[model samples]
Target chain A: MIPVTVLTGFLGSGKTTLLARLLKSPEFARTAVIINEFGAVGIDHDLVEAGEESFVQLETGCLCCTIRGDLEATMADLVARRADGVVPPFERIVIETSGLADPAPILNAIMSEGARGSGLALGGIVTTVDAVTGLATLAREAQSVRQAAVADRLILTKSDLAGEAADLRVRLAALNPRAPLSEALFGEIDAGVLLYTEYDRLDDFHTHTHHVHADDIQCIAIRRSEPMRALTLTLLLEALADHCGAGLLRLKGIINVAEYPHRPAIIHGVQHIFHAPAWLEGWSTADHDTRLVLIGRGLSEAWVLNLIAAIEAEIAEIAPQQAPAPL
Target chain B: MDEALLALITSSLALWERAGDVRREAGGAIALESEGHEVRITRAAPDVPFRWSITIDGRARVASSVPGLLRVLRAGLDPDFRPSRVRIAPIGITPS
Candidate 1:
């Protein structure tokens, strides 16, 4: 599977600076790049130096909104061209989303069935935070907070120009405790570390409490010891999307399906778009508890727990009558 | 079950960021009023496949499940409440 890394940040967070530097490195020489910029003209692509065969610039609109459909088509075309020997055979892809774009929808597009069938897998997400104005941006922009909250690796860019942002680090850590924090001076950092990270299983929620930000964006973790039926899980997701709407920003979980006790299902969702559960070979550890992390705006913990309970109870009550009888 | 439904309705309203009132009426019915829209939900007869009877503006509709009931309630209460349909990407390869 070809891994796709999403590099995102707020406006003027030095994403292009970082990408340009990475493309010059030996590590990112064989990588394909997709740069998305809002408005009629995009300048970020011109800043990045790479071979023309494997580089694409989306200047139509933001990848998360109007051009979401175009993203899948673009990747598919790129894959086809590579297979046909039309373009260079790049082993990986890096999509640099627009500064104001929401990463969740872009993620959903990458994890869609069409992209997966074309041999694309989600590598990881790297979000850049400006060290000089990171605190003020996080305070003023909800998009900035979301970009940091969903990242697997957080890079503080332009660190040489600013003093130590201890408060910003604390705030980011509170919002996302699992992501490792790194500092980049002039967008220079280790490319391997940024591109080759895995999504960490949310196992620390037992000790860490749910965090709510000033903009009403919240990080909620749900853990279930009992395995859920596949149907129950489906209903739960549907209910959440129907009721929460945009309030449900992102939801990802490693679920323990009752029918498949050995193979766990990995589920990822953004707003209403949910990827079909990908079954894993086996549990990584002895613990088989289902772990879910939900980042949203104004979501109540008790209400979510109650919603799950109510759905399970209702399903159990009707399952017996709906079960097929022996001949 | 009524208590659970009441809580769910209350939370649903909060999630939508709309001001409303959800309360349990006598005879195990849950009533909700928001922005001049009124909705009442009650358990349906056991003989029918439908599980709940949702009444909106005096027009009663039978809902097959709790999700269906919530959909109706949202339609009545919030004018801007457009249900985001869940699309499950098909797994495995399809004919290219």
Candidate 2:
């Protein structure tokens, strides 16, 4: 499946700036980028440099709502053209949604349309938060909160202008504990880390030191040394998927499952629904630690920590039941 | 398990498009019953080798594994079912 990354953020959150930088990278040489701007005058599209490959500017109101039909038609056309060899063969697609857009509908379009959705797997969702005024914006703009909530990787932009980003990081974490927060220096980061592997790389279970935006919100990371038993992880995921799936917004991680140790399982979930975990040949990085980051609204850090501990303990006691021969 | 069985489940789920309701019950169970067919999804015991088991119309069906179960579900719901590609991947491979 082709991976498609969705980029969402509030107004002036540096989404366009980030996209501009990313499009220039050699990593995006084979990428097809779709930029959607709200107004008729699409200036943001002008800012980004497009290679000989496909670069579409969608100026159809709100992409998820008013222009859904148009967006679908555009995607269909892109697919048809690509299939017919009418366009360059792009390996991946990235959508830069307008600042005011809601990403849920956009995702629904890709997932429900099996041919279209299946053909292009959701690589991940990336949302940008303006470091200087992010806390106030999130507090006042519910969409901003929702945008951050659904991100697999939250890129904190304009950190240099802010006094200190530690407080802003905390607030973002509280809104969406499952997303791994990374700072973007002048809208740029290592292409290897920022470009590919969308939501699949977010490690919500591990606690790493981050420049927390505020002290009230705690960002924690958990890492497991050994492959976790499949049943234990499944149960834990199911419970989370059942009770607080919506709150989860986004969850991404590479898990070392005992059932399939040689091949790591990559998991991605949005809200309550989760895609069936995909198997990868081996760990992408030399470090095999099971790392996960959780960003959510008022999610109990201690409760989550205890839950993981309890599940780990239960895994040891779950022996397979044996039965006598049925001769 | 086969194309016919898969079509049956897809039709039933597609029927509820207007309602937009998806149901998953306790103990990781899912049931779908319609005019003539029924489907139930249950988790298998760890020793079974398969992670999931699905029964169609009260009759046990065979799926080699969880990915296989997803394949079955996709066949039932999706009109187009090429195992490697889903509904949205670019049909042709040429770079544009």
Best-performing candidate as measured by DockQ: 1
Share of reference contacts found in each model: 0.39, 0.00
Q: Per-prediction interface RMSD?
A: 4.8, 15.6
Worst 10 residues of 2 chain A by lDDT: A318-327
Q: Give the TM-score of candidate 2.
A: 0.60
lDDT of 1 by residue, B1-96 (tens): 666778878887876677889899877888888877788888899999899898988988888766777787877777777987663322331112
lDDT tens digits, residues A1-327, model 2? Answer: 777788899999998888888777888877777888887778887888878775755564778767455666666667777889987888878888988887766765554354244376677788999999888888888778778876768998998788578878877766566567887887786555456555345432335533232322334455677666666566556544533444554555677776566666665555555555666667656666665554434344444544455445433434444211111
Q: lDDT per model, in order?
A: 0.79, 0.62
Give candidate 1's error at residue A116 in angstroms: 1.8
Give me the runs in candidate 2 sitting further than 4 Å from their true place. Answer: A38-49, A57-77, A104-119, A149-193, A199-220, A285-289, A301-319, A322-327, B1-96
TM-score of 1: 0.85
* DockQ-based class of model 2: incorrect
What TM-score would chain B receive for each of the candidates shown? 0.80, 0.47
Candidate 2's DockQ is: 0.03
TM of each candidate vs. truth: 0.85, 0.60
